[model samples]
Target: MSLLSVLRAELAFGMTPLLDMASISVLEGERIGFIGRNGSGKSSLLAAMAGRLALDGGEVRRRDGLRVVLVEQEPALPLAASLRASLAARGGLRAADLEGDDWRSTARLQEFLQRFDLDGAIDPQQCSGGERKRAALALAFASQADILLLDEPTNHLDLDGIETLENLLIDEQRGQRAAIIITHDRRFLDRVATRIIELDRGALQSYPGNFAAYESRKALAMQSEALERRRFDRFWTQEEAWIRKGVEARRTRNEGRVRRLERLRAQREQRRERLGSVSMGVAPGERSGRMVAELEGVSKSFGVRAIVRDLSLRLMRGDRLALIGPNGAGKSTLLKLILGQIAPDAGTVRGGTRREIAFFDQQREALDPDKTLIETISPGSDWIEIGSSRKHVIAYLGEFLFPPRRTEAPVRTLSGGERNRLLLARLFARPANLLVLDEPTNDLDMETLELLEATLADYEGTLLLVSHDRRFLDNLATQCLVAEGNGLWKEYVGGYSDWLRQRAPPPRAEPTAAAEQDGEDGAGRQARPLAQRAAKLGFNERRELESLPGLIASLEQELAAMQERMARADYHRQGPEQIRSDRARSQQIEVLLEEKLRRWVELDARRPA
Candidate 1:
């Protein structure tokens, strides 16, 4: 039997049709991803399936004795209840009801909490945003529902938390349990989705395979449609010319036919025009100086506790920096200091003169929840009235995957991912020479995230980003700044993977005379001053470390040579075996070049003044 099925479902919110004759069947162990633009009825359809929103027509069916659970974008856990109490209230295994009288339920809850890196559950009332979401997810997992519905499950989850959720879903899939996940996270969809179902115009359409397949299909469909339109246009032009050139009697006889043809052409044109493009425009700005921001001896302290200390760094133009560390490790504090939002206890913080800056904070608190989407997009406009600007609003929201009808909806009514997309839509609508983004990808869908990444990759500004999304950082960041223990900050000159390699504790150092002389044979070796080693290294070692420029130039030469060889191999009419060998050789060269590039990064990191 099917785990769940919706047949000819029809639902509406007041005058708006939320779902119109939408039919879908989900079987046991099937993992489906529900995708659509903001306000595209994804949530409404989920609600209808869960029996929270009554269907106007048709019916929903489920297997006998099957339990269903729905998790919303903004998880609704009772804030006043303790974590343990909340879990117990959710009808899960209780501590007192567990066999062996071992507090197994409590232990399980603790295990999940620790797995998500959440701290002690003192007064769940005061839990952080991320913590609350984690707690809610834990309750859902503990409930052991047969059919699980997750809406934007990755919202507010860090990279580690997202990975944990992915692993949980994979485990469930392996166990033959079914799930329907509504998310904009492309990476998550790529990892977990077995199939994708898009909710468009209150109708459901299933795409076989994963999110990537859906995208490829959509692109191909659009291209085919474009080709068909061009063909129709050519035919229509010829027909119109023939009609205009015809004798008077012939024209009179064919007037009705021409009118009918005109109507058909108009209908086709309308259909073609309905597939709107994602348009985005950034205002022109003056180029920033080589150094966008600089910090020297910077320290921030709250009362007696230090958050950041003695941090010194320089942000150059075109530098894309990712700030990473554990929660509450002062990543945000460091950003605030850079933005001058808070004064440092001691140090010099400088930014390039005349540099224009834009920031997208973690919470996106800059957006007013009470405001309508149209109002948010064009605030205090005299010429473009709220209702009159529907076309403009639709055009603008299209870029962020929001529909025209959602422009008048209150921001408060939008989902987490919707709000995040709106904030980004607004951010990109403007232009700046420097951008400071904190967790920009938190609530965005995979498609939107890819668009944002593409936009940023082409952005000609300095970027200081704080994100837990490894893929986002790997794709966009050219440098990394880690907020480490004891208010310390370390900067690496490469991307996330490069930073990880550098951070891997340097291979155990061999015992030396200095180690024995300083009585630092074992534990004391770690205590040895790094300054002493720097002092001991000779000028040649320093020069070797500083040879990054030369190495980079040499790598560039090798890369160019490899490209030339690949081009020759492609153009030459060699046998299939020789062609295959050439391709393999080219790939080997590319791999070597990548390794050398990483080595250049390491050398750059060790450069002396």
Candidate 2:
């Protein structure tokens, strides 16, 4: 059953078309992942669907009295109200009303707040970005709306928060509720989406499945579309050649052929071409010393709170490292210490020789809102040097999807994603042997994210990245430095998923003598001896546990071999079926490895102390 439908939507900004005859429907029990390039009006489409934005032409039809909620990318709350009061207002209830007879409503609201780990009495204005996002989500979920329009809900969320949201959204699949989400988190989409809707060149295209399935299907579609386009162009070219023949031939040309040629010209004129991808490159400066940066027993703190306690690590040349932690985990402080911008409180930090550094700030503080794009890229001259070649500033901005008209516009006019792209444009314009990026993937579109990932993968410089994007970290990081609570940080080999596999669970507390004698713990569960726990497993389970290590090793070898094959340039150019098959197999291996690792952990927990 359809909850809402958009009919031939047409919208435009000035001379640019934002939604050109675009249409879509929201059906019950469907979670749609809305995607597109940056500045392609994805947010606007959400607004229109939520009845917050009026279309210039066409209409939106909603089921009678259907409740729809729109969660903005950067949600704004009433400054003077408490978080609980804000939710009350959003749900069309007064705070006083909630305090009275509506026990169910109040309980529901509190439940969501608790689930999101938010304080209900806190002022909305005092909340952090992640907290604010959680507040908005809590409001959305508590509203019990028929359809939810969520824009970048994962923007400021940490890995744990993202996982929580993924589970909640997946649970929504069992109900009649529906959602249309606009996000750049690929893993989130793969986990939560029942279908994918793409907004490309002012048109909406739907793909039936999750992100991985969308990738495979879109690849094949693009290939077929390319072939069809070539055939059309070939015929158009022959018609053009015939029409341009001598005047005598034109006078004698068949009337029917002339009409067909005119129709062809019209058809060609009305066609919209696909937007080009971003062309990005880095200029790696002169090689630095083999040791990039090293910290000896580094410890940092503010007053009584320890940020990084006795953390020691060495960064070598060509090392691609990632910092994973919750917000306010002192990632910025760690970066500053490594860069020698700030001294550690109790340890020695050393920087390598001849190291030129470039940084991408997550807050985009380095960008001046008043400056034009051209001025930002090339300050004093019309041309700038990129590695040995000098290129016009306007041309360089164009490569980043900034039109010539927009080059002279101030940075404040650009959207969030556009601002990030501009920052990337500025960052890569310079040469550096060390790159430190903090949350660089926050507002980037998927295409730009993939391009940046590829560019960084090919970079010769040592990289230090702090991002919450799981897929991005998996693709690029060679090592992960994870924050284990209470200022302790640990380093693991490989990326985000690697850290998950290698990390051990917190040790269980030993039972007291009294509890041992009683054969029960304080929680009233059985407190078995180590031998008894080991013997509890069935024969099949024991066999599986013993075989897990071998299975894990075999899968890792296969995954590594597949990765090596994919590293070759020719692997990507293979047929769509082969490419899709390889991608599916790779994902399967990763999933299997993670499952086995989890089982191994479970089984290993029962071993003798």
Candidate 3:
């Protein structure tokens, strides 16, 4: 039996149709992985199923008396209270509210908190964002609802927390529970989901199996769409050519043919809307000296608490370094010290010769919330100067996907992903060599994140970044600086995955000798569980990885064309926006090409040669 069902659902945001004539069903024991681009209505559709939002049309039905729990992306937990107190207040687990056999509920709640790395003794007010989120997750699980709806549950979780969450959701009990998860972490979805559903073009589409299976299927669908569009395009071209010949050619009796051409035009526009090209116009900043920033015995403390202590590191041009650690691990503090916003207590922080830095702070320190999109970019000037050439403000805003109608909208009105894009746009405008970004992926959707990855891929300067998105870090970082909270720092070659392997504890010491001799059963019991925890991938990923090299070469060829164009003497004569836009595209392609190349090599190396 289905846990919930939606039939002929229709939803609209202003004039924008989100879901139209869409039907979806949640079945018992089914773990659905929901995916779509941002604003594709994944969250809204979930809300509809949970009866939190009213649908414009159609019906939603849930099993009578069924309990549903929703864990929001931005957890709405009480602040100003202890984390334990907040959790204990739920599920009738409180000491005062507890009845017979209710102590188990309280114990279960405690276990959840511990698993998420949230100590029950800590105050929610004092906890960092990630800790607060952990507490929220604990609360959601403790509810013991019949169905669970989680939105981006992995966002702020550390690597260990992410793995633990995966284990909990994939275990027998939780695995059979009816639930839907919306996550951009492909790895997480692959591990936890039994099936995949994508919300695309105002419809719900399902694909059996996991993320890899969905990707394989989605690729085939895209190929089909491309072919169909090509066929239509050929037909449309012939009709348009005939129609344009003369007024007599478009006879009154054949008026239907002209209307058909108009319908074809609309269909083409719809297809373009569904699958858009990526254009990241992040200008490659000026080149700096070989060394960009250096930290020598840097120490920082806030009264009794130490954040960074005797930490030493150097940033070199062309270095793509990712800073990773726990919530309060001083990644942001380190970025500040390098930028000279704050001084290190016991060490020297210096920049390389001619180093100009651009910072994309998670808080968006450079943006003026009161300013409109246009004002933020060009201020009062009607034009923005890109390398001494002036480009119209509206045109400049367009490069970052801001439509002309929305150019005057206040920055505060933009969504988090849009704001991040704005931050990147502003950051790229500066001719800087050192780019330091702190938690830039905080609320960005997958598409924006992918675009940012491409832009930074071609970045010719030094990059120091802190992000929780594993995919983002894996795609860009040349090295990783791991901040082991409390001032300990470790540098690992490659990305977060490499660091995880480097940090993994060694295996247990052969059953402690004496215990092994006690009995064969004792040895067997000890060894049984240790042998249970190990794994690998399947066909879709292997196939995708194998195809990356060819894709990479194609991108490189296109990148070379952009580069060749930029090298022409008259390139600058093209409007400054065009010149800069081409350069940004060149950089984006370069980054994407390298990403594919690396992925192909990694996947290839895992096998015979």
Best by lDDT: 2
Give the residue spans of candidate 1 off by over 4 A: 14-16, 79-81, 92-107, 119-121, 224-275, 303-306, 369-418, 429-431, 497-502, 505-609
Mind giving the per-residue lDDT tens digits that candidate 1 earns over 552-587? 577567757755765673545765345444443443
Residue pairs that clash (backbone atoms under 3 angstroms), model 1? 184-445, 184-446, 186-446
lDDT of 3: 0.75
State the displacement of the C-alpha of residue 516, model 3, in Å, after optimal TM-score superposition. 11
Mark the regions of model 2 whose C-alpha exceeds 4 Å error after superposition.
246-253, 506-558, 568-609
Task: Output the TM-score of candidate 2.
Answer: 0.89
Scored against the true structure, residue 535 in model 1 reaches a CA lDDT of 44
Error of 2 at 214 (Å): 0.6
Which runs of model 3 end up more than 4 angstroms from their true locations? 79-81, 88-95, 98-102, 121-127, 172-175, 236-272, 275-278, 387-389, 504-609
For candidate 2, lDDT tens digit of each residue in 422-451?
Answer: 999999999999999999998899889988
Ranking according to TM-score, highest score first: 2, 3, 1
Residue 601 local lDDT, model 2: 77
Q: Which prediction has more favorable TM-score, 1 or 3? A: 3
lDDT of each: 0.72, 0.87, 0.75
RMSD of each predicted structure: 11.6, 4.7, 7.7
